[model samples]
Target: MSWMEDLLLLGIGGIAVSVYGVVAGLLLLGIDRKLVARMQARIGPPIRQPFVDVQKLFTKQNIVPEHAVAWLFNGAPVVALVSSLVILLYLPIGSIPPVLSGYGDLILIMYLLTIPALALVAGGFSSGSPYATVGAQREMVTMISYELPLAIVFIAIAWRMSADGIGDPFSLVTIMQYPLWGLVGPLGLIGGLILLFILLLVTPAELSRIPFDTPEAETELAGGLLVEYSGKNLAMFYTAQGVKTLVMASILIALFLPWNPSGLLGLGGILAAGIDIAFFLLKLVVVVFASVTLVRAMVARFRITQVVGMYWLFLGLMGIIALILLGIDAIGGA
Candidate 1:
């Protein structure tokens, strides 16, 4: 195809992916709420509650605090939502490939992941509320805390793949083609599980969900980073939150659990793809349950100190141990 056709196709694909990301992301968020409530022995709002909440917020009057920097306070939500959607285009959906694939995908995602949180910090600071400021500071600190363990998990996996002569080990396509579980021995298997465990723990902090929700501790900060937000802007942030939850879950599925039962069942062609896609969505449900909903139901919000200690100190150490085991396994196999 010519460059013009490519561009047109790309544009169409981008729009399609964005729509899917928004809808699927919101649905997952609502499902998470329902599951968390059930786990807590309370009847939660309907699965469509997130959709309703977003719609209601869109219709409300958007308020800007008089003391706030009007420009950034307004712009942050737009950036957060758009960037989160951008991430979806780079991810594979079941048997479908990424809309935009390249060698630098993981690196690109690593950078893109930071943008939403940075936007949150900007929005918080721009709002000029003491609560928002504190929340923003906490958000930044939390971001720093999680990066070490997150890096160890991805890098260890990619590095192991490279050692086995896999090309472009950092590529999601490549990783999916050669899952770590298939490549590892007993030692490596244990290490891979530990890394998976680390990643699962990291998920809550990435989403700013419970146990890591100090940034938005409503009980204390009265919504903290979002204290001054309302109406359309707040709706955008809320939707972005859901989209980001999808992003994290998708990444987790891509990394440690990119399996489909189609192969086991001897499926092929469109039917196989369909089955795989359905299975991929099911994996999303299980992963979101394990990483977000289960944690939310079981764990209370961690103080900033606890957040730092948990991610940087505890998880960080475990990540290193896992990486060491993978290295030893590689050596023994060689």
Candidate 2:
């Protein structure tokens, strides 16, 4: 494709992914409300409730704290939105992400994922609100806890792919074509399953959902890091949140559902793409439902220390074992 063609596709694909994020995130929130209602045996708001909430937030007046840094306080939400959107641009949504895949190393995606969290921390610190400051601290702590296991999980996958003798292409596009899961060798499958569980655990925390929502613990911090935001500023944060939710889910899919959409494996293009997209979204929803909704219901919020301990002790150990297993399997194959 020509440079202009690539640029156009990138713009269109990026916008499509952003729109999907908005729609899917809102739907997931509504689904959570309904699911919770079902679990609690109570009525729930309409599926449109999240949309209504965002609209109301937008209509609210913007509030700036006298003690807040005016520039950063105003710029925070934009930073979040841009960071999250840039991540979406790097990811493969319904089909693929353009303009980023040539250099779309998994490590690059990892760095992009950190951007929103860093932006949130900066925004919170600049707000000069006690709640915001506390939230920022919690966010940093949570990032420290989860990042190790998440990195291990990605590295394990890449390591496994290299062991398969695919010549070390760590881009999602390359890994997507390999049938690592199809190996299903006892140790490899076991390790992959363990890593998948760890990834699922990290997903909600990364997205700041229920149990790991310490950064925005509303009951305790009165909206936590966002306590001081209002109007358009709040709207940007809200939208970035929606985008981030989709980004996390998409990453899960890309890592786990690496099936081909172009039907290279004896399947026709249209049929293969349909199967790929369907299974991809289905896997994503299942992951979201389990991690964000079911886990939230099953577990109570942990103390900060307990949260950190859980990630480092349980999830971290799991990742380490997973990598070891993959290494052993790779050696055996070699």
lDDT top scorer: 1
Scanning candidate 2 in windows of ten residues, the lowest lDDT window is 90-99
Q: Candidate 1 on 1-334: residue-level lDDT in tens?
A: 6989978978998999888888888999999999988988899999999999999999999999999999999999999999999988888899788888773578788889989999999999999999999999999999999999999998999999988988899889888889999998999999999999998998889899999999999998999999999999999999999889889999999998888788899988999889998898888999999999998889778899999998888999999999999999999887
Where is model 1 poorest over a 10-residue stretch in terms of lDDT? 99-108
Error of 1 at 104 (Å): 3.6
lDDT for each residue of candidate 2 in 1-334, tens digit (9 for 90 to 100): 6989978977887777677777777776777777877777788888778788888988899999999998998888998888888876667754544347776778988888888898888889999999999999999999999999999988889888877777755787676667558654678888999988998899889978778999998888888788899998988898788777777888877788665445555666567667766666776677677778788777777777878999999999989998888777777766
Task: Give residue 49's error in model 1 in angstroms.
Answer: 0.7
Error of 1 at 152 (Å): 0.6
After TM-score superposition, what is the CA distance of residue 150 in candidate 1 from its true location, in Å?
0.5
lDDT of each: 0.92, 0.80
Error of 2 at 141 (Å): 0.7
